[model samples]
Target: MASMNNATEGQHDPATPLFDAVSHPNSLSKQVTRFFGLGQDRIENILPGTPFQRDVMDCAAKDGQRAVGHVVFEIPQDVDTARLAAAWKETVHQTPALRTCAYTSNTGDVFQVVLRESFVFSWMDWTSLGLKDEVVQDEAAAAVAGPRCNRFVLLDNPDTNERLLIWTFSYALVDTAFQERVLGRVLKAYKDAHDELPRQLETPDSSQATPEEDPNPNPNPNPSRILKIPQVADMERATQFWRKYFSGLDASAFPPLSPPLTIPSPDAQAEHRISYSSPIQRKWSSTTLCRAALAILLSRYTHSPGALFGVVTKQAPMLDQHQLMMDRPTRTVVPIHVSCAPDQSVSDVMGTIDAHDHAMRQFVHAGLRNISSTGDNASAACGFQTVLLVTDSDTKRAATWEILKKTE
Candidate 1:
C-alpha cells in the first residue's frame, strides 16, 4: 500500500505507532503542531448533562451492576495491536459520546466532561490461566466494571486461533444506535491506520445532525433530545407542553414499587440482542405493538382504563461522521401516556396509540422538562423505565454495511 500521509521532517510518523500514548504536545506552536502533529490530546468542550443522562447516572450508581453492553468481533491473526489501540484512541477523540464521562458536583448537578487525555491502552491476557471462553468473556466484561462508556478488550484462544474483540460500554449513554456509529469509526480508523493512510481526526461544522435514516422525520429533534445548544425557547416550549399534558396527573399516577430488574446472566444479553435488536413481525409496528400491550397489561393490573408509561428515544446520525451530534446525550426518556376506549377493538386501540405517538413526538424536544414536574422527575422517569428502543432491521443494516465497505 502506498503511504497516503504527507508529512515533512521532524514530524509525527503516521505509520509507526500512530498514538503517542504517554505524552501531550511538546510546547510547540499551533502551526508546528498542526503541520507535524500526532494529534495532540485536547478536549474541545465540557457541557452540562441533559436531564436524561443525569437521571440514568444517578439510578445506575445506586443500582447493583447493571449489564454493560458489548460488541463481539472476529479479527485476523496478523491484525496490528498497536495500530488498533491508536485507532481506538482516534475514534474516541473524534466521537463525543465515547469521550465523555460524567460527574455530579457537590451541589448535585451532573456535568458531562470530555476527556482527550493521552491514550493509555491497557490489555489483560487470560490465555495463560487456561480459562474457557465463557470465563474469558466474563473477565472481559469485568474489566469495564464501573461507569464504563468505552473500553476495547481482546480475548484470545491460541488453540483455535480464535480472537474476540469486545467493545464494552454502558447502556446509559451508548445505546444500540450509538454503538454502531462508534464501531464504524473504530473499524474505519483501524483499517486506515493498517494501510498507512492519514485520517483527519477533527473538523468543525456547527450545523445540527442531518437525517441519515428518515423513515419518518420529526420536527427539530435536536431540542427534543437536548442536543447541541438548544434554544431557551425550545426548552420553555417543552416545559409548557409537558405541564399541560400532565395537568391532571401527579407522581401518584405511577405505582409505588419500582419494577424488578433481572440481573445479567450468560447468554441472556446475547439472546436479547439477536431477538429484540432485530425486527419482529407484528400487525402494528413494533413500537405501536409494545405500547398497546403495556397499556393493556397496566390497565388490567391497576384496574384502570389506561396506562401511563415512558419511552426512551435514541437520536440518529446513524452512521459515523463528523456531524453536529458528536457530543451531548441524545437519548432522553419521554412520558408516554396511553388510553383506549372500552368499546375499542385491539386493532383500533393500536391505531389510536400509533397515531398519538406520531403526533406527540413533534413535541418531544420542547417538552421533556415538565412531564411529571421537572424537579426531580424520578417518578416520571420510573413510570416508563423500559426503553422500547427501535433498531434497524437486519436486511437494512447489512445493506448499509455493504455500501460502507464499498466506499473509497
Candidate 2:
C-alpha cells in the first residue's frame, strides 16, 4: 500500500519551471496558446489530482468510494423522456470534467485521466417498482451514497413524473459551486433541446473573451486537457509563517472532545439527526459568531486560553487563471489557531476570527505545501484537534454548527 511519504519521494516542488510551464502559464500569450491546444483532437492528458483529491482516494481505498452529493428534482409532466436523455448526453459531451475518472497508482499518486471515448451516463426508470415517494427518495440518496465505481447516475420515476439525478465524484473534481453550474447547464440544455430554441449559445473562448466580459463562463471546449493544482510562489515563506503561528501550541492546546465516544463495530451502524435555525441578529458575521462561541466553549472545557481547530474553505481565488477558467474544485480545510484571553470580550474573538479568515488563503497554500513536502495525508486533520463546520440554513437566514473530533 502506498503511503504519504512514498508519494513525495520523486516529486518536485510544483512551483518549479517545468511544473509551472505545464500547469500555469505566466503570460497571456502562453495562456492563449494553451487554450487553443486544449481544443485539439487526439490529445490525451492526465492531470495530477489535488491534495484534497489524493486524501479522498486514500480513504476510498479503505472505506470504498461513495457519492459525496445526491439530489432529486421533479420532472414536469410535459417533458419528453427521450429529449431529456438527449439533453443529458449533450451536456456530458460539453463538459469535459464530467467524463474524466480518477486513476490511482501504486505509489500513491492520483490522476484524473480524460477518457478517449465517452459513455452515456446510467439512467433508470423506477416507476415499475411501485415504491412510495418517500421510499423512492431514500433509494435515490442511497444509490448515490452507496458504494459504486461510476462517477454519476440518473434515475427516473415515470409514475410520479419525477426524475432523480444521483452522482458522486471526488471533491477534487467538483465542489458545490461547480456542481451547481453543471446542474444549471444540464437544465438549460434540456430546455433548449426540448423547446427547439433557435438561439445559439456559443462556448466562451478564453483566448478571445476578456475577464470582465465573460465573468461566468463554461469550461474549456477541449475535453482532454487536464487541469493542474495551484501552488504558492514562496512555499518556504508560507511554511515559516505557519511554523511561527503554531509555535507555542502543544498537543494539549486543543484537547479531545469531551464525553469520549467509542467507535462502532464493523457490523454496527450509526444514525445522526440534525436541526438548525437562523442566527439571531449579532454584530459579528455568522462565521465569526460560531468561532467565538467555539473558542469560549473550548476554553471553558479545556481550561486553556486558546483553541485550535480546522476550518473548511473554498479557496477559489488562489487557483491559477487557467484552473479558475476550468471550473475545478479547490476546497481545502486548514488549521486555525485562535486565542481567547480571560480579559478578552466576544467582540475581540470575532475580530481575531475575521483577521484569521482574511489570511486563510496563505494558510491553505502553506498547509498543502507542507503536505506535499512531507507526503503527509492531506485529509488527516494535520494535527488539528477539532473541526468546526458552520453550514448555511436553507433560507440563508442563519447557520448551523457541526463540530467533529479527529480520530487517529
Candidate 3:
C-alpha cells in the first residue's frame, strides 16, 4: 500500500500511516484511504449534517436504503473494455465525494464521513446472464437503488455493445444537477482515454512508457478542496430562525387529497402520471409565476386566503466558497407563506412572491436554518403537513401534486 507520506505535500498528514494495520493485506480499505488522502490515524473525516442530508438519512433508516439517482448509457462499439475501465477508475480517483458514507452518532446527530477505505467499484458482464435487455436494465436499476453504500456499478453487454453505468449515492450525497455533471465527466473521461489509446499504439517507443512516466495526470490538482461542509456555527443562526418561524403554525394546515384505503395489497399497482409544459415570458421568472399560481389554487382549494408550502432552494453561496464542490443534494427546502386575495392579479401575486423570496433570502442570510430534524418533528407533532412542490426550470415551469402528509 502506498504510504501517506507519498501523498501530495501540504494536503495530508505527514506522519500518519496510510493503514492502521501494516500486516493487513492489500485491501480495498487501504486503497480508499490512500486515494482520498485520509490520515491513517483518523479513520474518517467527520462532516456536519445539513438539514437535507439529515432528513434523507432518517427516511432511509425507516425505508430500505434506495438510490436517489441513476443514469444509463451505451458505450460505442469501438470503445475497448480496458479504456472504459480506465476511464471509470480515473473518474473515481478524481471525485472524492463519490466515496462518502453517512452515519448517525450515538447521541442522534446525523453526519457524513469520508470512507477512507472500503471503496469498491464493480464491472460486470451481463451478456451471459441470459436475460432480456429490459430485465437487465431493471436489475441494474435495482442494484443501484438497493445499496446503502456510495459507489458506482458498470454493467456491460459484450454482445450488444450496450453499457449500463449506475452511479448510486445517498440523497445526501448527490442531487439531479450533480448527477448530470458526473455523467458528463464520466463520458468525457472515456472519450479522452479512447482518443489517447490510438496515439500510444502508434508511438515507436510506446513499450518504453511506464505507468509512473505517463504524461497525462489528473486535471484537478486539488480535489480535496472541492467541498467544505458547513460548520455548526454557520448553521446555528439559521436553525434557530427556522425553529421559530414554524412555531405555532398549524400542522394540519395542509390536508391529504383523499382518505386512505382500508385494504392494503402486497402486489404492485400501476400509477398514472402526466406532465404539461408551456413557455413563460422572460419579464416574469418561472418561479414567481408558479408560486403565484400555486398560491391562488391552494387558497381556493383550502378556502383560505393564504397558504404555506415548502419550496426547495439551493444553499446560499455565502455559506461555502466551493459551492459546487460536492454533487450531493444540499438544497434546503423550507416552508414559504403565500397570500392571494380574491381580487389579486397574477402580476400582483408575482410581486408578492418576489418580496417574500427576498425576505426569505435575507432571513437565510441572517442565519435562518430552514429545516432541522428536531424542528420538523416538532412541527409534525403540532400537525404540520407538506402540501405541494413547485419547481421552475430555466425555460419551463413544472409542478407536482401529492397527497398532503405529515413528516414521519
Candidate 4:
C-alpha cells in the first residue's frame, strides 16, 4: 500500500492509525443495529461495543485479568493440517469479528473496528511437542497483546482416529454462538478441500509470518489491554453507598418466619405463583409497581417493616463512565434490600427501589461485587428468596434457578 501512488495516499491520514479511526479510506462500512438497552445509536462501521465487553476489558486493564475464552474441538484423524489451516484462514477472511479489535479514538471515543488488512490466521500445533494445552495457551496469551481468534490443532493421530482443535478467542470480538458458526464454515471448507487446499499458510513461527508494520498504527492498538480505566472514584463511591444500605443486614439478621405450609422435601421446595394487581402508575415501571406490592404484602405477612428480593435486569450498571454499546450478555441479578416501614406510604418503598436502580446504572455492579467479597455464606446471606425480571421484545432474557440441597 505504501508503494501506491500519491492519489491513493491522499485518501487517508498517514500519521494516524487508519484501521482504528472513525473514518477509513476506500472501505465498505455498515451500521450495527444491535440494541444494548442504554439507548445507544449504532453507527456505520463504528461500534462502541457492549457493556460486558467493556467491563471485561476494564478488568484486564485494571485488574490484570484478560477476558480470553478457549474452547477445545475434537476432529477426525487423517485430517490434513495444511488444508485445515487454509480453511480457517478462509473463514477468518469472511468473518469481520474474527479480525475486529477495540480502540480509543483521539477524540476520547471507544470503538471496535475491523482491521482493514487481510486477516492473518495464526495457529500452533502442540501434538508432536508432547506439551499440555495450558502451556500453549499461556504462551499465546503472553505473546498476543492484541485481540485475536487463534487455533491449535491435535493432529496425525492413528489410534483413536481423533484429533483436537483448541480455539482461543478474545471476548472483545464475538461470543461463543458466533464462534460456532465460524468453525462450522471452516470444517465445511476443510471437507471441500479434501484433494487440494485453496491456499497455503505460513507457520506462525516462520520469519515471513508477521505482516508489515502499519505505518501509523496507534501506539496502543489493543484498547482492551491498554485503555486506562479511571473508574476508582466512582467504584469507591458506589461501594460506600451499597455498604451503607446493607450495613448489619444479612439473612440471619432477618426475623424468623413461620414454617412452610407444605413440608419441605429434599427434592423440591415447591413454587407458588400467586397473582395480584395494584394501580399502575405512569411514572413508575411495571417492575417497580410489582415489587412494591410484593414488598408491602410480605411486610404485612411477616409483621416486619421491610423485605428483601432480587432484581434481574440488564442495566449494565457499570455503563455510565462510557457508552458501552456492543453485543454481549448484560443481564445481572442485583439484590434489592427494601427497608421501608409498613406505616410509611407506598411511595416510600417505590422511591427507594427507583433510587437503587438509578445508582445501579452508575457503578452498582462494582459496589455489589465489593459488598459480596466475603465468603460464600456471607454471599448466601445477602441473596434474596424472591426475584423480579422485566423484559421487552428489544432484548432477550433468560434465568437459571439453582436450589442448593443439603445432604444429611
Best by lDDT: 2
RMSD of 1: 15.4
lDDT of 3 by residue, 1-408 (tens): 011002232332211111211222233334434543444333333344554665555555545344353445445455565666565556554665665555454334344554333334456677665434534444344333332345545567768766655444556677656655555565677667655762222111111211122244334434333223444454455556556655654322344333221111223333323243656546666567666776677778888766665565655444344333444544565566666678888788898788767656533422112242335533332222442344534433111011011111
lDDT of each: 0.46, 0.49, 0.46, 0.46
| Residues 1-408 of candidate 2: C-alpha lDDT, one tens digit per residue | 122223344655533422343444223223322432333232233455555666666555544433344344445556554665556556655676765555554334455554333433455677665434533444344333322222334456656666644444444466656666666676677667755743232322211211112223344544324334334445545555565556655322344533221111133333333454545876667767777787788777777777766666656344443442334555666666678888998788889888878776654644343633432222222444455666565633111011111111
Q: Rank the candidates by TM-score, best first.
A: 2, 3, 1, 4
Candidate 1: tens digits of C-alpha lDDT, residues 291-385: 68767777667766666656755443222232235543466556666665577788987998887666555455432323334433322433443
lDDT of 2 at 368: 44
Q: Which of the two candidates, 2 or 3, achieves a greater TM-score against the reference?
A: 2
Candidate 4 clashes between residue pairs 3 or more apart in a chain or in different chains? 49-325, 49-326, 50-326
The candidate maximizing TM-score is: 2
Root-mean-square deviation of candidate 2 = 10.5
Q: In model 4, which range of ten residues has the least summed lDDT?
A: 399-408
Which stretches of model 1 miss by more than 4 angstroms? 1-41, 47-52, 60-74, 116-118, 123-149, 153-168, 197-231, 249-284, 300-303, 315-323, 327-329, 343-352, 358-370, 374-408
Comparing 1 and 3 on TM-score, the stronger one: 3
* Candidate 3 lowest-lDDT run of ten: 399-408
Q: Flag regions of model 4 displaced more than 4 Å.
A: 1-44, 62-65, 104-109, 117-143, 149-162, 191-196, 206-408
Question: Model 1, residue 317: displacement in angstroms?
Answer: 9.5
- Which residue ranges in model 3 land beyond 4 Å of their true spot? 1-45, 62-64, 67-72, 115-119, 127-148, 156-166, 194-233, 243-252, 256-281, 318-324, 342-345, 358-384, 391-408
